[model samples]
Target: MTSARIALVTGANQGLGRGLVEGLAARLGPDDLVLLTGRNAERVAGAVAHVAADPATRSRVAGRVLDVTDADAVARLAAELHDQYGGVDFVVSNASAMLTPDRSQSAQADDFIDVANGGALAVLRSFAPVLRAGGRLLVVASSLGTLGHLDPRLQPLFDGASLDEVEKAVESWRTALHTGTAEELGWPRWINVPSKVAQVAAVRAVAAERRDTDLPADRLIACVCPGLIDTALSRPWFTDFSGAQTPAQAATAVLDLLLTERVDPATYGELVRFGRVLDWHDGTPPQLPDGLLVN
Candidate 1:
């Protein structure tokens, strides 16, 4: 018999997370294992029970209460995975907390940092160890994280942006929108480019690190732009997207990238947007830079 592929998905109890859990569970055979994780024990139990009730998926899915923010706990879980399952073939970091409440109000510098640490980097460190050789690590990131795409464009929105010119451009755009003259200037209310770009970079960085090492086996990491799914983090404008894909659609897209074997090494760390894979460049995807590891 073929060895069962073992997968672990964080924030797997609801919305996009739950959608991914169900989609993946459906694709894999009964022998395969998919661990559904959440912070709430009751929620986790419910998620597990729901999966377990389905005859085709019941035997393959299990539940675990995991908080990705806790470094120690994350490390311990990684070790546990190593011991119990030997290694994990897929690790999806889908947990994220938005600071819009703070952003719109008295959100302090610490709050933004908290999102980066707790919501972004923390998740990366947590699953670093459990990833099997040739394993795939997928990080669910926002379009806001893309540096060149948004930071420079919206200086006012972001107190400290990396790209000054881009920030200024964004500030100008923001001002135009507020003055009831957005139609004259023609600008969209929402910007998703930055987050999408940043997500790709983060995933690529991890994949690049794993590729350059002298390890005996190969591994891949890539970020997926889930389009727009209906979730708590979603903004009101998201409803307007006529054909906006649902959480299930996003989950399927993610799984498609994860299951595909023909992805070139050069494209490993790049962003896969709109079902098309592309590299990081200014405005458009760039060609692979030399001396930069692509494998």
Candidate 2:
């Protein structure tokens, strides 16, 4: 009875989120449950039905409405899961702001707020305490979020502190972005790069706090980048798909990390892409191997 492994995924209605839920459904034991969540209940239900329609996965999938930006809503969900499932064994923080082709340029600054959530980091603040003892949480973050993306001069802002400090830094960047000084201030040309740095920063801070807690056992948390995938979320941004993988392909790799069930001390507070734990380089870009040849 206690052998049932419980897992949950945020933003499971589309794109990579749906892929992850499908991957979990296939990997987990017959009795295990994978809760597929989305901000919209109707969309979530539809996604679950589509993914779980297969007789093999139908029994393994469930749906719940979750808005990661809403703190109280997340708290309620956490409490409910605690009582109902005895706590969740796996959590994938995959909710991120989706940019549309018709989005107004004037509204871009406002979108920064969503970007600032750092997807996984912001949601984890509410969900971390509720994770089952010895459970794992994976943040669908990016390597672009590593400290190396920040200019060395501004990297100090993220040095050894709470997610609050990181949040504050993001607000500063947002203000600069609104004021048209972000470029002068050394924020990257790509919005995702700086925002991702915030995600990794939050993950690092929270992971350190978890290490000091009196929790039952290892509660592992880390940021994971699923690589460039051919999806609506990314297709508009990239001109090339030659190097990209499918959502299912990325999900398979991420699931391997989630189901590993134990943490590598080195990967404890890192941003992982595929299976590689990125090297932060202390705010310096990683140096390429000398004289490397490529065909």
Candidate 3:
């Protein structure tokens, strides 16, 4: 068994995910390993090469092909991790999809629900058993996904909803979208918003479940917004955004949560922005739409 710590990041072929893998490699001990994953084998290799190009991080980096939406692929990867590393110390669930503006509404909703929300759930469910106790699970989310943007009538339910309730609420939104009644039910037209909202809620629910089941009492699971980063996902709409941080800067905020030894109850299942925790249940207005990049 290896004594070095292990960290895995998904969708790391480009953008913030790539930056995150680089950042992790730079910070981890030489004996540590940072696994970068993506759906495309070639792209994953390219990212691995880029990160390994640095002499300081070269020996600490590797890559794998993984599509979060594919259950079999995720399960296979989990089994591989179990066999090789026993388990991982950190999992950055950075894989997500944002539909292009030209996509049809139904297509957009499908990508949001299936790729962003459902895919994240699949990753967490498949990897929960492989996440070492006291390890951190960081779900990269968006500030726009805050509960404040959700329907007022549904606020109370989300404020304290259990895992099952959150699942049902997400399903309800899916049904509404398919039935052409999402707007009537107060779901927003921005497809990514509802998906991320559910994603963040699910993170909280998962943390609560872990605590209630007495599993990994020290496990840290939370969602965070990386702030506006100049990435391919955001360049379309945020080319002139003055407050946008570089991908390297955004990666620091994520690493802060992943590498911290101290755990705070307030941070569990919370949406952290710019390294500060946000009150998910509070109805305060969310900060400006910083960028669209999920990471």
- Which has the greatest lDDT? 3
Worst 10 residues of 2 by lDDT: 286-295
TM-score winner: 3
lDDT of 3: 0.77
The TM-score of predicted model 1 comes to: 0.71
lDDT of 1 by residue, 105-206 (tens): 112223333333344455566566566666777777543334444333332333322333333444454445446553344332232333344344545555
- TM-scores, all candidates, are 0.71, 0.87, 0.89
- lDDT by residue (tens digit), candidate 2, 54-127: 65573389899887777778778888877877778889988877654344322454554563374455567767
Rank by TM-score (best first): 3, 2, 1
Comparison by TM-score, 2 against 3, better one: 3
Off by over 4 Å in 2: 1-3, 100-106, 115-119, 212-216, 282-295
List runs of model 1 lying over 4 Å from the truth: 1-3, 55-59, 98-117, 142-145, 151-200, 213-218, 235-237, 283-295
TM-score for candidate 2, please give it: 0.87
